[model samples]
Target: MTDHESAGTPPGTEPAPAADGSPAGPAGRFLARIALGARHLAAGLRHILTTGHQSDEEIRRTLVLRQLEAHDAVRDTAREELDAVRRRITRLELAGAEEGWTPEQRQQVRMLREERRRREAAARDMGRVPFVPVQPTADQIRRARHKGSTVRLLGLLAFLAALSWLLVQRPALLAPAALAALIWLWWSGGHPPVLAQRPVPDRLLARPELDPDAAPAALTAAPGQDDDQDQDTDLRHVTTADEATARIAAALAKRKVHVRSVAPAVRTAYGWQADLTLREGTVADVVAVLRRLDTDFRVGTGRTLAEGSTDDSAIVTLRVLTSDPFANPPAPPVRPPLSCSILDPVSDIVSLDGEPTPLYLAGTSVLAVAVMGGGKSSLVRDLADYVTACRDAVAVDIDPTGRGLGPLRRAALRTAYTPEAAEAELRRLLAEARRRTADLGETEDVWQVTPTTPAIVAFLDEYAQLTPEGKGLAIEVLRIARKARISLVVCTQDATADVMGDAVADVFPIRVLMPCRKADIGVTLWPSAVSEGWTAHHLTPGDDHAPHDAGRCFIWAPGHKRPILRYVPHIAPHDALQRAQERLDAGLPTLTATDGPQAAQAAAQPIVAVMLDAFAAAGAEELTVAELLDALAAVDPGHWTQWDTRPDRLAMGGREIKRALKDAGLPPVPTVRSKLPGRPSAYRLQDLKSALDETG
Candidate 1:
């Protein structure tokens, strides 16, 4: 006190009482500094606690939104420039007549107009930029909040506990510690000069930072190098399903096609596929834009394909082929074991994605339609090879071409090379089906094929070449042969209704459409086959005497609701011949007499027999055609009762009867008067007896 009085000459000054009535000494200043440090510490801790709680997904979403906002800013700038150019052009136009502008002024206006057009194009391009939303799920937010709350509570408690300990044991050092911590936090808040001066990690940059010494060479690099790098970046950016969808959307938009949404692309061995919902367009629109998409995606021509969805007209499936899927076709399926069951799938058909799909031949009729050199014969040979390798199956070849079966003819149980033989085989198959139906138990629907009673697989090649009666017999067999473990594989080059009737084409449960006319697909397969992604018509056929996409086909089966592109395995003629010989050496199974001679006799009996019996029952000398038909219906209701009434078959009443009678070599009986409104044609009982006697 004495020293202070001597130095300042102010008695009882007490540091002159600071602004807040505190002593203006070192202690007050120290207290102020400590308070400032505490405030800084609090703010830093608060910042960490608040920011640390954000989930990675939330941060990513924020970043994406920011990027989109940046893009919007760029587009707005382009629009502003466009508007400015338009205004300048307008000003020049207004000044030209009044001020009589020179050549330079007119050229300036023209250049401004060009600039406006370019800016407009740029703005449009920006608008077409694809955007896919990525938002955090409710569950993610819940879990993140829970974890952040737990961590923040624990941190707060830890800080409080440490402060309490410091106050109890080392209160003297608390202020200094707080001060040091505040200084450190402030120092770390900014980018340190030492670290900021150094180059960032290469992985952190979009493209690696060029070496200082090589920068000159990089600048001098060819322009193609930059183009290549840009292309690579474009390709790499589409590594994910979301990215692919976005890219495809952008590409389609450039062609004036808008889509509501595109499902995530599914990766396949061939390439990738995605289903899209169009905003307001047909599938044909999408198909039209595929060529441009190929160019945009850098895929080669014919790599992109679009098909309408069968369920909805607005839905389309887009397939992008990245590579040649059939560049390396799979080897032929291995031969079956010593005695494979016919119930199992016979061979493997490789799908477009290079996956092996089993081909089921039993319990299903197959219709294969293809153009010339479309590999129909090769498919037939492969099927025959499989059948010959099975112990519970026998092959029947009905080819009017005689050579359609190739060397596999050796494996057939019965080979028919003429229309008459084909009809005979069809009748025998029908009889076998009838016999099997009668033999089944009440609870059993399908006959269980065995070695002793094997199933029959009839291969009817050149079906269009068959006679009308033969075609009719084949259709009859198809209608009833399923339960008897008998199926047909009918191959045809023409699939028109006149060539292959609707009734015959519709009966097949399995359809194999090879390279043919586009119209043939709808006729040979289902009406919705083309819409369901059956693009067999797009497949290339042989040209200049060379096979192209010969084995490619779209397989539509009962189990497959949508058509799948498949490649039928090719079996060489020598391989097929060897397999046939092996099967013949093992001794094929044969049907018993009940299924052979007796069943054929029953099937071969003419419709005249029923008519004759009806005449006998009527006990009349003469009856009109209508009266005879009615009598026949009562005698044999199974065959004659609903003959002309079937919706699937052509309706012919009297003409059908006359045709049958004429086929039996019977003379036509004249019309008779039976007191009816119209004098109808009649068949006399004596004439029926005479016809039956002559045919016998």
Candidate 2:
């Protein structure tokens, strides 16, 4: 056969020779078929790797078992393309060797190795750095643990030693010296509890610490650097009070506040006190600088009071808290279990000096003044919950608009939404207050909770929204604050003279000044606050800054020098609802129009007429009040039960029966004697008939 014809028979297999001349062998044919099968297997593997049909997991499994083995590299393009598959398989095998033979184990080992390497590198870097000790704080330096006084005592002992030596030289002087020493000791012991004499104030000192030239780089660093550790480290060399003052001065200057000089830092009852003499600036400029210290500097600032200077420049006194007062604000006070007294633990005061001040909601009324969404309503709701929880407290809410107190209106015994309704409720409450006062009489000035004397708390929200008549009623209610045991909590958005009249404002000795629209309004609530530079205008509205100052406000009670920072804790709405539901389920009825005095008057008239007719039919003009009550009970047991019985009563007493009689419109038991001389006072049947006839 020709060479071309022979080449046409494919590579591994050949067509069998038909006739004579062509050679054919069984062993050759078998070897050719084997070669063909091997070639097909290689093609399948190439296709798999090129197409990426098999997953990585499958590829790994096949490579590990040697089911699909890698081939040698080649220079030709076609062979080189196949060689990439081998290389990929080899790389995967190497990776498997480095990792544990299992995928999950491999991942864990890789993470641990990475972590170990990172830790070792960190350690190497840390070893190369120098050690720097933290500097002692200013408070640490000033707190002597009575060491200075102890040193003074030692000096006194030394003087006494010298005196003893002199007496030893003259034996006769011992008796007189001993007596003098005893008298001195007695005098020292009898000294009043007054503070030790302090040295001249830092403001009065002309020390080099007060020299602005000493710190030419005053306020060189930006306010943001105050929080940097590097900044604190740079201050380690600040060994004297002068250096601290210079650092503060530098911080103020960086915020564009020109400072003439700074006084040496001095310890005071409030905190560190320093006077900063401004370079011809107003109080507004000083306030602007203080704002930067708190905002950009990230430092807790206290009151910054501006005083007039003789040189025409203002002297601003700075107070920096040693620690952040707001760092760990106390949680809102929890409601105590139901008790007879009207006292409650509501909020905690985070005083300017980082001290915790507890607020006890007792007999005093509270006035919360702020703009809308300033957390005033939250405070009111919390107190309302406490009032509703107390068994003796009568929670009455008055909101003419009904928006503020709507959610918790169910908790109130009497909720008045309209102006007319609110006025009526206020009048009734005033009457109740007068009645309570009369019950206390001169024998007891303070109200004590009995079944008869319940605490009446009128929680008035948005007092500025009250109508003319409602405002008048509110003024009347406030007048009975201490005298009639009536407490008023008046909340207003604008606590101006027009909104909250002086008489209404004076009723609430305890005031919470929330963030208002103007500082003057805060001053209206706390008159003395202007002098101390205390204002709530900086507090952010709503719960946006809740973690910092949501319920936070400046609180002024009767005995505080200035309004203090207090957090009026929030009560969960669900909790309030649950408490209210509990109260309602216990048979505490709502005080609606039907439950008012007019309703009682209408209801009692018919009953009175029936009883009077019954007495007249019995032909008795005069009968004892007890006998009349017995005749009524026999006629209508249900009406008698309504008037005479109280559910869930704490004790067995005649108070319920007496209350029933008064509620039925029966007059108080007469003191006039009966004709029988020894009998009880009598009710005239003829008068009852005449009263029934007049109604007809």
Highest-scoring model, lDDT: 1
Give per-residue CA lDDT, model 1, range 276-370, as digits (tens): 89766578667656667777777755467787876798888888877667778877766743467778885567876676666677767899999
Query: What's the true lDDT of residue 392 in model 1?
Result: 82
Model 1 poorest ten-residue lDDT run: 208-217
Question: Which pairs in model 1 have colliding backbones?
Answer: 625-681
The clash tally of candidate 1 reads 1
lDDT by residue for model 2 (126-180), tens: 4344222232334432333234345555776798799879988999998997777
* lDDT score at residue 544, model 2, on the 0-100 scale: 56
> Model 2: which ten-residue window has the lowest total lDDT?
66-75
What TM-score would candidate 2 get against the native? 0.46
The list of candidate 2 runs beyond 4 A from truth reads 1-245, 251-289, 292-329, 333-337, 343-356, 359-363, 404-407, 519-523, 526-528, 543-548, 586-696
lDDT of each: 0.66, 0.53
